[model samples]
Target: MHKTLSVATRLAAVAAVTLLGACAGMAPAPVFSQDSLPDTVKVPAGHRVVLETVGVGEITYECRAKAGDAMAFEWAFVGPRADLNGRDGKKLGTYFGPPATWASNDGSRITGTQVAVAPAKPGSIPLQLVRANPATGNGAMTGVSFVQRVATVGGVAPALPCDAAGAGRKEVVKYQADYIFWKPA
Candidate 1:
């Protein structure tokens, strides 16, 4: 009985260690570099990078008729729902929008516009070059000038057909991307 109890305790300890290691591997923090920013996200001469965040989100889309046509299917961006993470895997904020907003831990936020887009890998949303509208809060995002959504994975709109009958139908697509925020140097 003593030997059997010892074996059971050893097995439980091993299982606990394995579980902890797996959890640690689930979502490793992202690495960043200025040189790694995609060309699609243009940074005007002398503007410096202020912060970079890694975002995991769903890019929502709505099925509607193509513009200028009444019987076609087209996917239109509704907005996004994401959790922004810092380099240490800490939750920094949440991103959501019709006018994309990045609200950080310290209550700072910024909105932006799509200035440019580049092709992304198959099955993923296109890389975006966004220009910040202006800083709203007095947080980490204050004075932010531009933002880039790159290294995209998944989040493509579904291939559902949309007619006038399906005009308002919505779909949520899963995606992950790195968002780099910039400011004037």
Candidate 2:
């Protein structure tokens, strides 16, 4: 009987420790630093990151004439369609549209105007900063003030020939980028 009680107490202590460890793991995740990014893509002073998401999907480009020169055909950006995911790889939202919208799974959404952009590495999309418009539906996006797109891997316009023969053609390019959301501190 004595041996049994001792073993039972040890098991109980082990269970308690396991529970405490799990609770500790639930603490708020540490925010990522933006210091390594270019000044043009950095969030403004007094803003804090509220979320970090990786956007994975495709950007569409359409073969069209250059804005100022009809004779100069190129791939014009159509828009983007992507899944926004948390660091843990869970789908948290989506990014899409001609108007450039980001929508959270909980129904919150926002559009933004481009603030600036800096070139990323070769063959990658540019790093970008955007000023968020007022959010709709009220959730994770409610107070978002800015978004920075970084760590780009692809999503450049297609390398295929864009000429009069291919006018109006559309192509999709895969891309992955880290999108950090921020709000006033």
Candidate 3:
């Protein structure tokens, strides 16, 4: 009985070590670059990129009267629904909402206030910077100080006319952007 217990303990220890080693072998998160980004969307000094994710999904828009002008109508910005993926193309989390939440699969999440935005290429959505609030839960989102949205593609308002005839109609436009999360250096 004593010999059997000793062998089992040794096997468990080996398994634990192997598991830890496997985790350590995971590829490190990719580095972020801002050389081509506009100054308005750049992460502020003293922060370093901690995680970089690609957000691939859609933005919803609604046909509504232009704010402050009842006579004018347009496709108004609504919200986003996206999956955040790592460089390896694995789903790491999600981004969505009117409040704009970024949630990690590890159960960590954050909501942030928009800091600034700059126009991207003609057909793409603007690049943006956000200041993250204190994260809820823990894990990947903990200690995030900022989030930058760059490399935007096709998130602009729908091309459909937004006249009174289409009032209350909703449309979803496909988009992709890179979200780089930063922490104080």
TM-score (all chains, Cα) for each model: 0.76, 0.90, 0.83
lDDT of 2 by residue, 30-141 (tens): 7889879888888879999899999999999999999889999999999999999999999999999879899999999999999999999999999999999999998999
Candidate whose TM-score is highest: 2
lDDT of each: 0.83, 0.95, 0.94
Supply the TM-score for candidate 1: 0.76
Ten contiguous residues with the weakest lDDT in model 3: 1-10
Candidate 1 lDDT tens digits, 1-185: 35455888999999999999999889854434547556765566767766778899898899877778777768898889999997678999989997788899898888888898888889988888788877777989888888888789999988877667788999888889988888888
TM-score for candidate 2, residues paired by index: 0.90
Task: For candidate 3, write residues 1-185 as lDDT tens digits.
Answer: 35455888999999999999999999965488898888988988999989999999999999999889988999988999999999889999999998999999999999999999999989899999999999999899999999999999999998888998889999999999999999999
How many clashes in candidate 2? 0
Residue runs of model 3 more than 4 Å from their true location after superposition = 1-30
On lDDT, the leading prediction is 2
Tell me the number of clashing residue pairs for each predicted model. 0, 0, 0
